[model samples]
Target: MYRFIMSLMLVLPVSVFSALNYLQEDITNDTTWTIQDSPVYIYGNITVKNGATLTIMSGVEVYFMLVEGDGGFREGSELYIADGKLIAEGTQLLPVIFTSGGDIRSDGDWGCIAVEDDSVVNLNHCVIEYAKAGLIFWNLSSMSEMASSVNYCRIYHSSEVGILFYNSSPTINFNSIKNNRYGIQTQGLSSPTVNYNDICSNYSYNFRNLSGLNQDATSNWWGTTNINEIEANIYDYYDNHNYGVVDYTPFLESSYFNEGGIGDKSLGWLRSIFVP
Candidate 1:
């Protein structure tokens, strides 16, 4: 009788494990989540803390469960990183994906991927969509060999903001941040080296500067060559005197990365012209 019951439990456990992997609790140890376990479902608020490292290999998709209308992400499911590192090393051929699990195409389907307080991120070739805020960087002083970077990613359809930079500096280049309420919002003296991105076509303002510090956001395509059109989409010093002005001159006349996929840009450097 004991052996029969044990066999029953083992059969069901293997079947359930093969279907989905639910992730929660604190990641206290250095771990690697590979593509073999492709779809990781976030069941509750999970955190990577205590200077640990969480490396997510290429072609992995992270799905977050959500409440229908609340969308605050207080529903026990979110990913937060503090005093740690999240190295999601995706490539041009295969990109990492983050989206909702509710089978809905609406924005605010989930919360956000928040990285704060000395957490280093090397996020490349990723597609983050349908969240309250796609990614949030707060109070990180990443530098030198541990410099943080967000490259060759597609961040869009966020209900509030595509990316929020607060008191942090990361090399943000070669990204497509569009179709959101706010493409990028800066505050708390955040100074991201914003370049080589397609920042345009958001529902509200593309860029807003509440940090009150002059920013040098340059060399990026704004979906238009007309200065007035570009300025209209941004909320900066022109809209409010207290805010800092975004210097967006020498911008790219066309999209730098290819439309085919992530990091499919041409070999020769592009200047004031088409990038891909």
Candidate 2:
């Protein structure tokens, strides 16, 4: 698998001056809010609230300490993105950290770090690991129309899938998704533009799609070193490092390696942040 094989702690950057002031002033329950440490049995939904931006600092460990005491695994955490947004914009040098609390902690320990369907999710330069999946986008129609831009991130070592996209059209680029049951799982017409990623070494296939939209994975480092002809549709480019079935030789001659994926702004149906 394409696992990092080491546990790393990245230092995050401080919020910008204006953004910091805005966060301190607009955010509610800033002090009373609990920094999730132990497996706290959350029975209700947790919302960040409008005008309240929760800035998860980098290298700050968040442990989903859910326990399966006596009986089977108990019902754990469920973070409701009722409103507001989560800005986990970590840097390449200082990436944000989200992991289980204990040494032997399993994946999906807590509920998940969910971005409400109606809200905007901007995950830049973050390292999401050791959860059921790095991120989850659910109920696209209910949440805000803003699309998610997951860039320069590394997601690995999860129990289930890597990134799950339900009814959202997020742009995933410059990411390294490896060492998971499934790398990227797209279901129910969730059109995600995935490209320029090193998607390799997963237990199963790198990308899985069911909605049958224009989901593209191109110019990526697909766990192989062999250099040969390039193919796009219906070809396992990872194992062969080229066209496993289809013939992309004409495009390769012109140096056309990408699938020309459309960005979030061009989607014309969803709302999203800057196009990176």
Candidate 3:
């Protein structure tokens, strides 16, 4: 008599696996990071070389691993666009996320998204947190249309400045910049259009003018409508008249406290889920 044996097989879907991770690399051509690769890890500095474009899709999560080195000295996991372009456009419902990759998360976990000279950067509806600086514009070109634009973004929990500008004039509007050491810092003739943002609850200062150039920071909510409270939060020419004046007059009547979150709403739930 002959007997036959049967066996069972187990198969798993591709989506059940973890997302793809990347190391220090250069993007010399146009590339798109889709949402299917959720939680893409950046183990080291990723550079978009000259004449290249790096586009990130909505609902995508980019995690920056904490490497050993000083991020301020440009030795960490960062997205550097040098003479290149970065288009990170996310919808309100599915905004992109940039956060720390380690299990123990805190401020200054990674470097920043640095847009170097002659580079173009645009970020919309993105959540950037737990970094040295959320976004940085460094020595941008003088071209009128090459300004780095940041809108409807929630940039917070940065160990250093939230958004830093160095000789670059970008249009910054409708962003929730709070809970950082400094909300926005400008130097070397970097005069950005700072308006319609909720700048409050920062540790050191909300808006710092190191360029000594007059800045137009008006029509923003400073956590309170009280003039004394608002003025105390800003460190402009008034603090030391040698610096350029920061015209922060005509503050908004309504407080934008609730606007400090990811996407169109606050990410309090995500914070609770991750900060454990």
lDDT winner among the candidates?
Answer: 3
Ranking by lDDT: 3, 1, 2
Candidate 2 per-residue lDDT over residues 4-113, each given as its tens digit: 11121123233432321211122343322222321122222345676566666544444444434312122344344446667666676766665555556665554455
How many residue-pair clashes does candidate 1 contain? 0
**Would you estimate the TM-scores of all the predictions?**
0.82, 0.62, 0.83
lDDT of each: 0.76, 0.52, 0.77
Residue 42 lDDT in model 2? 29
Candidate 1 Cα deviation (angstroms), residue 89: 0.9
What does candidate 1's lDDT look like per residue over 1-276, in tens digits? 223433554667544633556665689899898899878877556789888998988999888776444333333256888778888888888898888866555787788888876688889999999988888887744332127889999999998999988887778899999999999898877778888899998998888888777666677888877777877888877687787777677677778774422222232123223311
Number of clashes recorded per candidate: 0, 9, 0
- Residue 80 lDDT in candidate 1: 83
Which portions of model 3 miss their true places by more than 4 Å? 1-19, 70-75, 140-146, 256-276
Can you list the residue pairs that collide in candidate 1? none
Stretches of candidate 2 exceeding 4 Å from the true structure: 1-46, 68-75, 140-146, 225-276
Which ten residues in a row are the worst by lDDT in model 1?
260-269
Residue 150 error, candidate 2, Å: 1.3
